[model samples]
Target chain A: MLDKDIKKNESADNFVLRLFVAGASANSARAISNIRSICELYLKNRYELEIVDVYQQPLLAQQEQLIALPLLIKKNPLPERRMFGDMSDLKKVLKGLGINEVI
Target chain B: MDYSAKNKSKLNVLPKTPTGISGLDDITRGGLPQGRPTLICGGAGSGKTLMSLEFIINGATKYNEPGVFMAFEEKTEELILNVASLGFDLASLIKSKKVSLDYVYVDRNDMEETGQFDLDGVFIRLGYAIDQIGAKRVVLDTIENLFSDLTNESIVRAELRRLFQWLKDKGVTAIITGEKGDKLLTRRGLEEYVSDCVIFLDHRIVNQISTRLLRVVKYRGSTHGTNEYPFLIDSDGISVLPVTSLHMDDVATSERISTGITSLDSMLGGKGFFRGSSILISGTAGTGKTNIAATFASSICDRGEKCIYFSFEESANQIVRNMRSIGLDLQKHIDAGLLEICATRPTMFGLEMHLVDMHKKVTEIKPDAVIIDPITNLVTVGSVNDVKSMLIRLIDFLQRGQITVLFTALTINKSVAEQTYEAISSLVDAWLLLRDIEFNGERNRGVYLMKSRGMKHSNQIREFIITDNGLDLVDVYLGPDGVLTGSAREAQILKEHTGDVLKGYQKTRKDREILRKKKILEATILTLKAEFESVEEELNRTYTEELLTRNILEKNRKEITNIRGTSSENNTEENGPHIET
Candidate 1:
């Protein structure tokens, strides 16, 4: 069935990613850039990135139980992954996001 | 050059924000500094939040100053409801736009630890609240809540500094409360952030009595009282009774008023107590200390001046009943709206709280005279020096206000030099010592004015009788016995009656003896007069017989010639001669 194939393709190819950061901090900027580069380089047209400023939306950050700034959450995937602290390590980021070796 | 005078002159009198608490503003020499953050640090359950909330609540109601209360620990409803017991209608105040509450809920999970964290969000919220209500007072209760979940301490410190600086820059008087630290004034060291003023509240147990004490730890630019004053958290809120007078600058009066007992007044220089002076009546139990106080209060009320009587040992009705038996109709004074009886148990409150209650009542009622019956009852709450200092403050306060105050203390033993009198002897302007003198198988009440600072008082103890007619001094011993009291007085009256009966009997006997002597003398005089008359009659009879015999003889002899005429003449001459003899 073409419908089942389309659903499977949407789940596997289309990525939902969210980035939480404090306002205008250097670490927040670095985390934002690194996460953005990773998403754009790995899944250019396949990912949907949502950037949220924690200070501006503290309630939203609280709802997500955020303890640290410059945090990233991968949604819409089979298993969700959370990464924070030293996000500049590309290998660690890729390993936490569970990216395939082909990507 | 007087350097002390120069320094005193150079002192800067800072602008103050009134706390609007009874006796608190007086102790603070106005209040906390204006446009500055004052830190109120205390242990848990020490009433830190309640005190700060009272500041804001009093600001809104009394000073007409709108306030913003940003609670870091409790919700707005909880804070409002909790302070309602203090008669602070915060909900109504907020509803009327006089008070604004913003609970800054900081969930630790959302607040991450970092090297740099600005309290800009908090400042924005507080500033918004202040602007919305046009508030002039702010209270931030508990500053440690923001860092409860934070791992880094440096950021919390920096943010606290900025927060206080921003609050001061806003030109609003603020109060910041914090938990007391073991080694520091505050757990998070918030006292360092607030540089203008710092207040420390402590809840301590002295003699098993929980007493809340408050002191101004530091006030940078103003002269404030430095004594630890006991505060009360009752239905009325925190009221601190600071040292009443820093200097004895009272304008003493030389006018004297009676103690209602004429004899006692005579003992006190015949003019009674000095107006506006504190009188201490020290006596043993049942020596009539309360009677003395009741008489004094009754006299004050009779003079058209109001008097407040505080009876810690007896209820109002009990005092009235007891005083009635002493011929002091205190109920009439109460009915006339001139006498107020405030009766409570001494163990109900500590010395400071008791003093606060007195201050509140004094301020509210504004009586011309105050009577504290048995001031010794307060000794159970504190040490000797403590009660002494409390009385000193009380006396100073009443004297400075030109209000007459009387304190009755019970001396429990024969060693008056080492008992209650020793505690308040120096503070009282006049002291009257009442004692129970037992002599000749009788106990008589005697009162002596030991000292009247500005008047000459009698040192001799005068035995006084409290009869149904009132108290009177027995000027003399009567009825072949000594001065008597109670049934002894009645027995003396009966003895005098018997003596009068004996005097009457002796008087009648002497009258009877005089009557018998007068009767005997009258009988003797009558006998002598009767004897004289009888002798005169015998002489006349004898003379008559002789004249007759002479006439017969003359007749016989004159038979021969004119004998009858001659005999008749002879007889007449003889009769007249006999009568004369």
Candidate 2:
């Protein structure tokens, strides 16, 4: 019973995120920076974020059926969410993540 | 010679537009500058207009870059319809905003009557068209048509410089076509120095054969092909090939295609020529040079591969009919789009134009193989050096594309099948010699492979014949008479008769000797049998004598035994009396 509670706590603290970028274009670089800033400002202590360069790892990107670049995918915490665009708007991103409200 | 521009960064330069022509890109390394003026100069009927139109149409439709064509000579409708035969839909392209056609309408007659002229009006009209459609490419067809012969040379020179500068400043790739003269590059030589690139097109006839050629006279800031190339102009447009003259490693094929003759194929490593290679069939008139070339071409086309036949000495219909008489019908292939026939007299135009025409046709047809029925007919119009250079360029262009090119030459000597001139021999990859050999009261046609690159061909001459079906190369008739010379064959026949007579005499003598040996052996057997019978009789007589002597002795011994028994009985009775005493 103690082990189950510990596992739940660990799951809540760890977060898995992935992004698919088609090319080394200008927009792709901007999206990468914005996502990194959002994670550090609000969820730094509560969750862990992983950045993946899809151009370098095309095979993995293909496995996720990625069609365009600058795509953010929330892989952890059941019912995964995906957002595609410049990734600058934090409100729409939080809504996509099921946050219900932006802190 | 100039390195001052090297310090400037080139990272901001735009990517070049691909021309998409076969060998042009390879020669230019990629394509022409994306947004720069390129000058194309040539003489009358030298394909300047055709080449310019091809560039513009290709850029617009093929590359999706809008282009504007301003012809100072041909009308808009004539130019459009002319290129339409090449499968270029200029009308549709213009309607869709991809291409624009305009005619500058420059007439020397009008200029002579007016006595005053300026090219400013021409530039204004061209610039307006370019601006209206946002065209990235522009063509000035035959710019020389705008000039009058009596115009001041200094003014012409200045105007050319300004024209090139303005086009460059506009940042659009423009082609300014010119008319070549006997001495000067153009009526005015100013364009050659002012343009970043200068291309020269030539049309010449040699030995009644017309050829078209293209050469890069000058190219700044880049290396290009320096050799003259054969080109062709037909309904498909203009194509320039630098040929295989570029010094680079060429891959040779080991797999061979059948020559359609069993004996010939077996002699050539059990196959035939490499998939793509040039073959030279040379022989004197009536020595079957055309027959061999036609047979090879027809056989290749029969295999479902496309072939192009350029007959400089005969008409297309005539060649087809003549070949049909020999049982090779090429009309079926022509209808199937597998065989294309292009016939023309070399003297009808310049030798360089003939080359260009061939290049153009080959590109449009995209044939796997090409045949020049007799290249010798083309030698009449130019000097030996000119013909050699043109032929070299032609071969070079075909080799680069890996297109199999076959050329026929008429040798001087009836016995010799290849040209001993040494001009074209060194450049050819393979040479097939067809000769007439006289033997046995008849002149026989012998075919042999003199040399084939990367192939093991027969060194012996084989008798070849053209039959109802096609060429049939017979086996080498190596007889005991040493190559079957007339006198040697007769001597061999006489020697064979003598040999039979001598063999009969030896058999008779051997038969007599065997009969004599058989009689002697039979006599010896008879004597041995008699001696055995005599020995048997003597043994039997001796045995009978011994039997008689033994019988008498046995009778005497029986009487002695009976007397001994009586004595024993008497002794037994006496023994009892002695014991009592």
Candidate 3:
């Protein structure tokens, strides 16, 4: 799944992502696994991932303007994009971040 | 189909969390529904947020349950600072991990999410705040801030419902405050989503006095007080007063007190008032209401028991000074620590706030007697219904503590029909009425026992007077005409005294005249008797001489007969002449 905005501004090829969680919530755990599977299947050796526990780093969450939980933010893929919820829809999550196919 | 039984079988029994508020817990039977969201909806400055925070703080401190406070409006520091005066040390609580405060700033201009956005952002913040503190209680204060300037109402509404359900799923009792609306409990009508329990707070101005009230609109699975109770926000924080819970079944006492007047006590079945009973003295202006109240309060103090006087009309010093004129020194009791005078204006707060203050003072002082000087002034703060409700609560509370309560009400008219709010009169155990009886171009004070439950009282009207020595009650003058009092009674008594004196003088004059006439007649009769006796003595001497002459004649007749005849004739003539006279 490719996004036109990402295609136009392809300044970064590697993906930098941040996942926000609150104490191993079901959505947080599921979103964590979904992000891991998506990275392994599509971006593999090209992605860097970081998971933030808002319960521990609430100041960080506030500074980042995080409003929703289990949120996935793609930071290093040209333009940043955000997706909310458990990130279960692979195609939707990939398109939201402006990624094309599996590599 | 046995639907009733079937429904009962499926019905869920909800547990409660005591709010630790004074009257609230008793009214709620326990507290808010546990592990569920309770909605607190009210207008601005109605103590909604304060009450919500108090619930959480009390849970942490008193119930050993940690709490989380999430705000969509106020910042954490601002919230902390605002509550600092209420004796809530939020910062310390946070430091001790007993409380976690989170603020989610949802600025309308900045919150224009372009794509799919769930409220999970604030949700996660709140969830984290709760998890970090292991909070059993959660408070989302004024979450309506999220709906401000938002184009998406449906989504926001759904998110709020989901958030509440999620809190319930997490098994944390939560409080959600919402803004009151024109025709709905909440601005968005969120009362539908908050189904477990709904508390509505109301703040309004009546007769130019602001009053805050609380009502439990709905409470599932348990019975709750349904009246609109007055809630107060002061140094101690917000407290809901459960008014109108009239538990009239308290045991009646046989012990009595003086009615503050000796004659008045005799009127009240030879006693003053029953212990734990409520006495209401109602009168118009200048009927010695304050004097009676002062006497009652002073008497309680004199008994070595504490007395609290809520004087709406006079300050403590003013009462002390004024009562001195009547020869009652109340300051001595105050100095001795047996009396406390709380002088507050009736307009200072609403009715329920007054009740809450009284409750607080009573609990703090543990007074044996309480006097509210002129409770009718409370009508200025609220409607008749509100005042009645407040009085009921006060009477119930004081009775529960077995405190003898005396209340004075200033009335426009002394007639029962003219009393604007007589509901309080009905609630009292004894009622003493002080009236100004205008007669003979003079106004006089009269005291009458209107009613005293469970005790016999005098039906006669007694003249009530406040002298320099104290209260004095004199028997009303019941001349053949009607009852007389004051100067008229004095004049009647004076008139009767003059009439009695005049009658006694007339009776003595008549007795003297009779004695003088009798002496005159007795003197005349004695003179007449002396004259007659003299005549008779002369005649008897004559008769004896004649007899001697006759004897000589008779002897001489044997010797000289002619001499006898002449002597006898002369003697007879003398005797006859005496008899004739």
Candidate 4:
């Protein structure tokens, strides 16, 4: 069933991303702003993003096996990918997310 | 600063948290720095994980302090299963909320690094676990995994520094384990970040026998043992032997205890070994070293006190059966809980492990006496010096508890035996040497006190005999040639006894002959006296008769001459005739 959902999301070209961060930290804020702008400019309205604060949901951080802050996990992509850091390097972030060209 | 005030402040400036592992706290001098991180670095399979887990478990169980264990290499279940053999029920500790386990599975294959990142997630998770259990201790076992999981070395290093600072700020005593490097203490130099304390564990095989050693490399504010101490890992977990007591001021007692052989006791000041003293019984093979050790053990048990016998040469049943032949009923003492026989091959473990095992047993049983039968077998596992050092530690431990210990050592060669005893004899209070007295084409056992400190002991070597009744020490015969033993001594005694009887008989016969000669001499003197008296009587009668004849002749003549009252001349003539007759 999870595979079917991922396939359906992939057919519709919907981008699902989960970003784990510590609450209100400078790195978390920078990562949030950087990814928001990149997603708006590149995927437009075709992407869905969920921001989770590990401070508020520490068990979620353990479940995700998170070691670094501002970790991004792409959910709906056929091949899931994880990226660590504040998402400041746009080229590396875009490459990790499988985005080829600028919008 | 005033000196007194400075000393007062220094007394407790570094409050330590006690690690409940045996002997570790002793060497660490009350354990690791409190509320600070201690880095434990060692090579692979060197018991890094096991030692850290024991720290957490000991904290949670013994100190009543909750702890968190975060594993970077092993998962939580694997970590639990790994320590199960040590009798640590991690799952139960977790259920009771005394411990929390977190496995940070970081696989480099599944993640990519885009830019700058920090370890806030690890911090939050660790903080959450600590808060959940109010933990005062934490363990991040081999956080060096981060260096492998991440491509950025600078980030991992920086984050580790921050993590250590965070752990310190949170006020929890933590242990961070790392893999040893070729040149540095840790592969990633984790020791640089956790600077409050550093411990090094090493596992090395010497002479095909592997020994685990632990060393406290540095303690920031406290003095710790700097020597590399041998540690043991068994069902009870890791035990680091301090190897030597810092002080040699153990109180000596004047009380004495029996050595189970009455005549042997007579050799040793007519009492026995001093209480709480180490006694060494050394001899060649088949010289009844084990028999003497068993006798000591039985003597202890006979006093209704507990005794533990550690046999490296024989099994428990074999020792029991063998001892029974010499009238030592060890099984009854064992059944009565006064005696415990622990038999293990010397090759089964390193010398340190055997020492730790004996230490643990002594601690558990609190015995009054201990016996190590044939400690020479331990030479198979370690060098003579190694055995000596191990025995030094063992004796120190047993002496501190005021327990008398008897050690039996087998002498292989004369020179080596002397060398071995020369190394260990000084450490003991009394030394009993058993040797084979080879004389008259027979090998007889002889025992002599090489030295008994603070006592007047016999210098004579007694003939040692093991009979159906028990062990006995007979005074060896000093013969014309030399010391006599076995049948030669008996024969010499018999010869002297017979000679005494023959000498007495000859003296009596000579005395009787002299008495018979004296009686014959007395009879001859009496007969000679009788003959002499008879002859004198005959002479007197003849003289008297002659005088009477002269008188009769004179009377007749006088009568013829007128009644011959004649003249003075005639009377003169008659008197002259009588005198001539």
Top candidate, metric TM-score: 4
Tens-digit per-residue lDDT, B267-291, candidate 4: 9889999999999999988999999
Clashing pairs in 1: none
Write model 1 residue lDDT over B179-286, tens digit each, in one string.
989999987788888978999999988888878889999999888888898887778887778855678889888888898988777777788888899988888888
The digit string of per-residue lDDT tens for model 3 on B1-581 reads 69987996698756899888777887788899999899999998888889889998999999999999887778889999999999999899999999988877644432223333456667666767777789999998888777773455777788888988899899999899999998999988888888989998889787777778888999988899988877778788876767676556777778888867788889988888999999888888999988888888887787898999999998889999999999999888989999999999988876777888898899889999999988888877776776787788788988988999998988886453235437777889888888999999999999998999988899999999999989988899999879999899999999999999999999998888888888888888888988889999999999998997776555544532433534554444344233321
DockQ of each: 0.13, 0.00, 0.16, 0.70
Q: Candidate 3 at B578: error in angstroms?
A: 32
Model 4 chain B, poorest ten-residue lDDT window? B572-581
**Model 2 misplaced stretches (Cα beyond 4 Å):** A1-103, B1-32, B44-47, B70-127, B140-166, B177-193, B202-213, B269-271, B281-372, B381-408, B414-422, B428-432, B447-449, B452-458, B461-481, B485-581
For model 1 chain B, where is the 10-residue window of minimal lDDT?
B108-117
- Mark the regions of model 4 whose C-alpha exceeds 4 Å error after superposition: A1-12, A99-103, B1-12, B515-581
**Tens-digit lDDT track of model 2 for B1-581:** 14646644444543465666656666666667667777778778887887888888888878877888977688889988888788888898889888878765532221211111223434555666677678889887766654553244555565567777888888888888887866877766646544567778887654555577778776667777877766766555655666546454566566577665677788788888776678888766677777777777778888999889898878878878888877988888888888888888777777666766787777678887899978877666666666677778777777667778888888775322233335687778788888777777766677888888887777888777778777777754567644643344445667878989999999988897888788777777778877877787788777876775565445445544554756655545444333321
* Docking quality category of candidate 3 according to DockQ thresholds: incorrect
* TM-scores for chain A over all candidates: 0.82, 0.75, 0.82, 0.87
Any residue pairs clashing in model 4, and if so which?
A: B558-B564
Q: Model 4 in CAPRI terms: which quality?
A: medium
Among the numbered candidates, top lDDT falls to 4
Q: Considering TM-score, where higher is better, how would the candidates rank from best to worst?
A: 4, 1, 3, 2
* Fraction of native Cα contacts reproduced by each candidate: 0.00, 0.00, 0.21, 0.87
Interface RMSD of each: 7.0, 28.3, 5.0, 0.9
